[model samples]
Target chain A: MSDGARERILAKVRAALADVPRGEEPEDVVVTRGYVRAHTGGELIGLLVDRLTDYRAVVHRVPAAEVAEAVAQALKRRGVRRIVVPPDLPTRWTAASSVVAVADEALAVAELDGVDGVVTGCALAVAETGTIVLDAGVAQGRRAISLVPDYHLCVVRADQVVGDVPDAVALLDPGRPLTWISGPSATSDIELDRVEGVHGPRTLEVVIAE
Target chain B: MSGTFVGMPAFPEAASAATQNAQLRHNLRKATHTIRGKRAAVVSELDDWAELRAAGKAIKDRTLRHLDVYLEQLEEAVTAAGGHVHWAADAAEANAIVTRLVRATGETEVVKVKSMATQEIELNEALAEAGITAYETDLAELIVQLGEDRPSHILVPAIHRNRAEIREIFNRTMAEWGVPAPANLSDEPRALAEAARVHLRDKFLNAKVAVSGANFAVAETGTLVVLESEGNGRMCLTLPETLISVVGIEKLVPTWQDLEVFMQLLPRSSTGERMNPYTSTWTGSTPGDGPGDFHLVLLDNGRTDVLADEVGRQSLRCIRCSACLNICPVYERAGGHAYGSVYPGPIGAILTPQLRGTSSELDASLPYASSLCGACYEVCPVAIDIPEVLVHLRGKVVEGKGTTVERVAMGAAGWVLGDEKRLGLAQRAAGKARGLVPKRHLPGPGAAWTDTRDIPDIPEESFRDWWAGRGRGQQR
Candidate 1:
C-alpha cells in the first residue's frame, strides 16, 4: 500500500524484464466486439448465464428494482428457508426474502452450513470468455461465503462486464483477494467425463440486474 | 532422489493400472473437464490472450537464456533484503539445505504451502524420513497427504477424490496426523471443509517452520510471490518463525514489472479468475511482521540440461497455471499418476523427459503420452508447443537407440530405394508379387500397429508399371 513498496516492486519487475529477448512484438489485447447483443448489464448477466449453463449452473434474471423479489423467489423455488448474506450486501437486495438472513460475521461452520444460498456481487465480468470474478471486498463477502454454500446467487451489473481478459485484468487490484467463476464448480476425471459441484457451488445462479 | 513412486513401471504400465480404475477415471474426467471449461471461458475473454501468452513465454525463455546472470542478480537482491540464498544443483543437495535449515530452527514440525518443487524433490517424504513432520496446509493437499495418495491435479491436487471420499479420508486419517476429525463428519461440502479447517488450525497456530514454493521470484527486490485460492497459503506464509522456500531457478522474473505480466497470465489461466483470492508477497524477512529467518533454496535439477536444447528450452516458460493439464485430452484420460512425476499432463510429458532424461523407462515413455492434438498449445497461457516437444523427444528416443527394429527395417528399405535400377527391379518384382501381399499385416513386432488399425493393401500395380505400359517410363 505504501508508495515506497510499490516503487520497489516495480523496480524488481523492470530488472526481471531487462534480459528478456525481444522477439515478435506482442499485440495489444482488444476488448471490444459485438458478437452477443446485450446491454452492459445484460451482457454481464448473459456471460454468467452462458458460462454457468456450460458449467451446468442454473441462471436467473431480474429487474434492478426487483432484485430483492428475485432473490426471495429463487430461494423459495429451491425450497431454501434460510440464506447467508455478506455483512456489506445492500439491505434492499434481500428485503423481499422472508427467509432468515444470516450475516457472515464470525459465524460458526455449522451455522453457516445451515444456510441454503449466499448472495453477493462480483468484482468484474469478462465477456470474451464468460467469467465472473470476485474480490473479497464489501459487495463480495469473505472467501468462505461463496465457497461454503451449496447454492450461490451472485449479482452482476452490465457496466461491470468487460469485453475481454485484458480488460478484466485492468479492472482488478492485485492487492485484493479475487475469485473467478465461470459456472458452478465442476471436475472431469481421467475418462474425460464431467462432474459438477465438487468444491464451490453445486447450484450457481446468476441474477443479472439490468 | 529415490522417492515413494520411484521404481514405478513405465507410463504404459502405470497407465494400464490407472485406465482400468473406473472410479479414478471418473474423478479425473470430472475435475479436468470442469477446470478446463472454466479456463477456456476465462481465457477467451481476452482478445490479447495470444499476446499475453507470447509475452509470458518470451519472458521465461529470455530469463532461461541468461539464467546464470538472473540467478546471480536474484541472489544479490535476496541477500540485500535480509534473506540467504543457497543454490542446489540436485534434489539431494536441495533437500539437505532445507532439512538443515529446519533443523537449525530446532523444530520437528513444519507447515507447508503446496509447492511442486518440494514434491519434485520429495521434500516432505525426505523430511519425514529425517524425523521431521511437514503438514500440508492447502485443503486439497491435506486430503491427499492424509489419504496417503499422490496428487493427481496441478492446481487442485485432490482432483482424484469426490466429496464423499474426501470425508472418508478426513474421518479415517485426520487423528493420526495431528487434530482429530469431528466425530460425525458428513459428506456435505461445508462440513468437510470445516473438518479440515478444525484439523489444520492447530498446525498453523503452532508451526515454527514453514516451507513454500514460490510462483514468481522478483530479481530486482528479491521478493517471493505465492498466489492461492484459499487463505491457507497466507497462514503458512505469515505465521511461522522460520520460512524456507524451495524454488526452481526458472521461477525468477527480473523485475516486478515483469511479474505484472505473469500475475495477469497466471490467475486468469489457472483458476479462471482475474486475480487470485490470496496473493502473498514477501521480501526476505520482515522484522516483527512475518518469519524472522528466511532461507531461499534455488534449485536447478536438470533445468540447465533442458535449457541446453534450443527447441526444448521453451518448457522453462511454463508458469504452472495447469491450464494445459485441464485442457489436455490425454491428461483427462490417463490422469496425472500415469506420468509418474509430480508434474503431470502435457507439461509433464515434455518436462519430465527433459529433466529426468529419457534414460529411465518412465521418463522415456512420457514423451509419447500425448495424441499430438495441439489442444494443449491452444490453451497454454505461455504458448508451449507441447506437440512439437513430444515429437522432438520422440526423435531423441529413436536416436538414443543404437539399433531398434524400426531403424533396421527402415535401413533395409533405404538400400532397396537407393538407385533407379534397383528401384525399378524392386517395383517390378513387387508388382509380380502383388497378389501375395496380405490384406492385413503379418503377425510379429508390426502386429501392434495392425491390432487396432486396418493395414493398407499394396496397390495391384506399381506406378512404374502403369507408366511403362502407357509408353512413357523409359523415354521420360
Candidate 2:
C-alpha cells in the first residue's frame, strides 16, 4: 500500500519538475568565501561558545572519556533530579549519572511536562551559527522530549559540526522529522524587552563531547 | 476566486475601525506575543535552523517555478491512485465544482477541516447557497462559525476573541447549528474545549462527505499532507466515505524529500513545536482504512498571476507559517480585520492585492498599511522580501492612477530642476515666501502627510546666493 502511494506521489512530482527550467539545482548556488579562515575543531568550538553565549545558551565542554561524569555534574549543578533519556541514547553517556532516569516515551502533554530535564545527542551542529539539528529518530527520541523538559542537555560530537547553513542543509534528510535549536526559547515584548522560555525548555545546555 | 472582496472600502477605513478597538487590540497583542515567544524558543534549539529555513525556501521556489508540471503530475498521480481531479480557475469555478461533487455524493452535509483555501473562496457560503451545509469541525473554526465571524489569525482562527466572548457565542449560537451548548457553560479554556468537542463529535462520525485543504501536497506520490494541533483533521480525512480537498496549486512540492524540509519548518514556524500532534496524509483513498472515494480540486484562482512577476513571485514561497504575522508591528497595531481578507498581515498585504488585483480602494491601500520596518521580512520562513514588494506595489498603484495633479506636480518640479536659473530663482523665492508658509502643512492632500509630522522651515538664504556672496575664491 505504501509503495503504491509513494509511486503515485512520485509521478506527480516528475510532472511538476518537467516544466521547471532545468537550471542548476539550488545546491549549486555559489557560496562566496569569507575573510575569516576555516578553523580547527578547537577554534570552531570556541566560535560556537561565543555565538551560543551571545544567544543566551549555556555552553560546556568535557573530554569524551568523562562524558558520563560531565552529564551527571551538569544535571546536579542545575538541581535536576529527574532526567529524560532518549530511547536510543548511548548507555555509556549516562552510566555515571545518579539522577532518576525516565525512558523517552510518547506520553500525553501533561505527563511529558512533568519531566525535569532531557539529555540527547544532536544530528549535527553549525559552528558558525551555534545551532543544533535533531532528527527525532534515535538519539533524539520523540520531538517532545527536548521540548517539554525545563532543561535540555544536547551532546554534540565535534565531527558532526558543520561550518555554514548551506553545508548543513546538504546533510539533512527532508523526509524524516528534524528539529533545529539555536538557544533556549525566547521572545520580546511590545517594549522590546526580551523574555526566555515561554513554551519549550527555559534553559538550554550544550555538552560538547570531545 | 469569484468570492473575492469586490466592494470593500479602502484599507484606511477598515484599519481605522480596527485601531479604535482597544479591547480587541489588547487581546490580539497578548495572544500573538505569547505564541511568538514560544516559537522563538523552540526555533533556537536547532543550530541548523537557518539551513533548514533556507532549504525550505529553496524547495518551495523550485516547486513554484515548475508548478504547472508538478500540478499535472499531481493530477495524474491522484487519478492513478483512484481519485478524480478538477481544475478551478477562480472561486466561482471552485464552488461550482465542489457543489456538484457533493450533489454527486448525494450528501447534503459535509464535515470540513480548518482550510484557509476554502475560506478564501467562501466555500461554505457558496455551499449554503447550493442547499448544502458544510460544518467546520476544527475547534477554533467551530467557534468562529458558531459566532458567524471571520478568522483573524492563520493558526488560531479565533485569536481575536477571549474565552468569555467564546462562551457567549457558543451558548447563543451552537443550538442553531446542530448541538446546543451546555446549560451552564463557563469561560474556562477546558470547559470551552469540551463543549466544542461534544458539539463536533456527532458531526464527525455521521458526515459521509469531508472537505479539506492540504498543507503540502507531495507530487512524488500524489500524497496530501495536513498538519494540525487538533486531531479533528485526522477524523475528517479518515472517517468520511468521500474526501474532497480544495488545494491551492502552489501547495505542491516536487517530492517526498521536499516534503521533509517543510515538515521541519512548518510545525516549528507555525505552532512553535518540534512536531505537530496530528499530521494526516492521504493519497486518493483506500478500500477500508479511509475514505473510499477522493476528489482533488486544484485551484488556480490568481496564483498564475502571482507567478508571472519576477520580484513578487517569492510570495508564493510562503508555507503559511504565520511567523510574518506574529512579528509584524503594523499587524500588531491595526489587527487582521483591517486587511479585509482571509489572509491577514504581511503575507496578506502582498498576496491579497496580487490575487484580487488593486482595482478597489481597499486593495490599493493595503500596500501602505505597514511602517516598512522590515520585521515581517526578517522572520518570514520562506524569506519573502515583504517591504520590497510593498514599495513595488505602491509604484504600481501610483502609476495606475495617472492622477493629473500628481503628474503636473512632478512635471513642474522637473522643469524647475532642469533649468539652473529657474531652480535658483525658485529657491530664493521660497526663502522670501517662508513667512507666508504655514508651519505645519499646505492643507488638503498635504495635510495627510503632515498630520503626524512637522514640515521643516525654509532658511533665510539659498545656498547659491550664499555662495555668490562669499565670492569664487572664498567659496572654500
Candidate 3:
C-alpha cells in the first residue's frame, strides 16, 4: 500500500487525492479541537480514588511516610507470602513486609504467573478515568510482571495523578511500551454483560501516597 | 468485502430470512439495547462530546487527505525502530507475508487478539491452510470460533448467541480445540468466561507466534496501539516470541497526541465504559518485554479505491467501535450475518459497497437497505454522514443500470410533456380511461408498489377540457 505495491500504492493514494490542493500540510487541515482536556473539578487524588473504586479496584490512601506500612498491610490483607518487584524498587517498601520479595531479572512467563502478586510504581495515573500507566520505569519492570500475575498492587504518588487522558498522554514517552490499566481484566462478550476477571489480573489493588 | 465472500445473497433476501428467526431477533434486540443504553450514559457524561467528535473526524480526514505522506513517515519510523515493516496491496499478499513470517520461526500455532483487519483478510483460514492453528483469545472471538460460526458484530462477535448456546458450544468443542470444558460448567457469563480463560491460557503461555491488528499507529514514533477489555491482548502481545500485526492504511494518526481523543471516544462508544480495562502501546520490539522480532504489515486491500471517491471516502473514518451497529434499527432486526461481511450494520452498508464496489447483488442492495432515518449519523463518534452516503451510493448504483420500471415510467412522462399537442392528447386519453384506472393499485407492474401505498385517483375531467368549455370566464 509493499514490494512492487509500495510505489504503486503510494501512486494510487496520490492519484486518489486529486480533490485536495497539492502541498497542503496536515496542520493546515483545520481540526476543530475545542474539547477541554479535563472534565472533572475539585481535588485530583480524591477523584482518582473515587474513579478507581468505581471500577472495582481496591484503593487506599495514606501519608507519604506510611507508604511502606501500607504496602505491607496490602500484602498481609491478601494473605500473600511471596511478592515480585523490580530491582530499582525501594528497599524500605518490601523491608516492612515479611514476605519473600523476588526481583524481576527477566522473569520467565511461568515464573511471573506463579507468584502471588506484583507491586510496582506507576509512571502516572488519570483521575477522570481510573487508570494506571506503566512505562517500564526504574521501579516498574517489564510489561509481563504486571500482566501475567493474577494480582497487581500498583503504587501511585499524589503528584503523578493527572486530571484527564490528554494530561496523562502529554506526560508519557511514545518510545517506551506503555500499558494503561483501569481495573482488573473484564469482558462483555456474553450477551453484552460485563463480567470482571479474565486472563489478566483478576484483582487490582492501588495505593495512593500523598 | 474480501474476495472470499463475493457471492452472498442480496440484502433483502438475507434480511428477510434473518428477521424471521424469532430467537435471533430477541437476542439482537436485547443485546443491542443493553449496549445502546450503556453507550448513551457514558457519552453524555462529558459536555464536550460534540467537540471531541468533530476533532476525531477532522483528524481522520486530515490523515486520509495526505495518507501517502503518513504512510511513508510511518514506514520510516517503524523501520528506524526494531520492527520489520511489510506493505501489502491486497489480502493475498498480507496472508503470504504472515504465513512466511510464522514459518520462519518453525511454529505451528499462534495466539490472536480480536482484530477486524485479520478477519477481513481471513488470516486464520490462511494460517490453517499453512498447517498453522490460530486460536482466537478474545472471549467473543472465542465464542465465535468454538461454535464454528461467523462473527455477526464487530466488538462482540457472539452477540447473536445467548449464554445457553455459548455453554453448548464450549461443552461440545472445547476438547477438540485443546482443553475440555468442566463437566459442571453452567450457563453463566462468569463461568463461561472462566472456561475460555482456562482454555486460552494454555495457548497464550505456550504460543511462540502471535498475530494482531492495531487500533491506531503513531506515525511520529512508530508506536502501535491496541485497546482491549480482556488481558488476552496483553498475553498475545507480550508473551509471544514472534509478533506480526496487520493494520489497514486508514488506522494511522499523525502523532501520539491523537490518541487522547480516541482513548476517550472509543471506550465510551464501544463498550459504553468510562475506560476499557487495558490499552497496550508498543514501538517495534522492546528489549526484554515483548516479542523479539516484530513485523508490521501495512495493508491496503482495496482501501485506495475507497479513497478515490469524494463522497465515499468518509467511511474510512470508522474505528470499528460497533456503536453504529448497536444503535441501528436495521441491524437490530436483520442481524450482522445478513450483511455477509466481517463489517456489519450501517458502517458496513456504506463501507462494504465502496471497498468491494456495487457490482455484486449483495453490495448493490446495501445502499437501498437503509430507511434513511439519520440515526446512525447522530450517534457516530467520527460523524460519518451515513444517510447521506447511503443516498449518494444509491445514486451510484442506479447510474448505468437502465432496465427499471421507474426509469421507463419517467421516460414516458418526459415524452408526453415535451410538446403541447402530446400533453393535450395524453390528458384527453387519460380522462376517457379514468373509470378503468383502479383507485389504489396500478395493474400489472405496480402491484408490489401499492402494498404499502395508494395510487392517487385520476381527475374525472381534464383541466384542458374544463378550460375550453368554460368560455370567457375561464379564459379571463
What is the number of backbone collisions in each predicted candidate, taken in the order shown? 29, 30, 1
Q: What C-alpha lDDT values do all the predictions have?
A: 0.74, 0.75, 0.91
Docking quality (DockQ) for each candidate? 0.06, 0.05, 0.76
Candidate 3 positional error at B261, Å: 1.1
| Tens-place lDDT digits, model 3, residues B121-240 | 899999989999989999988888878888899999889999999999999999999899989899989999899989888788788999999999999899999999889999999999
Interface RMSD of 2: 10.1
Better of 2 and 3 by TM-score: 3
Winner by TM-score: 3
Provide the lowest-lDDT 10-residue window in model 1 chain B. Answer: B272-281
- Error in Å for residue A159 of model 3: 0.8
In candidate 2, what are the lDDT values of residues B197-300, reduced to their tens digit? 66876686567899999898878778788876444675677667898999998898887656546656786788775555445556666554467889988777
lDDT by residue for model 2 over A1-210, one digit each (tens)? 122433443344444345445775534533222212222335777777776776678888788888888888888899888888887899888888888888855554455557789999988887755677776655878655676566889898878887644466567654444456767654321112233443346688888888
Give the better candidate number (1 or 3) by lDDT.
Answer: 3
Candidate 3 lDDT for residue A83: 82
Name model 1 segments beyond 4 Å from true: A1-210, B1-3, B400-405, B463-476
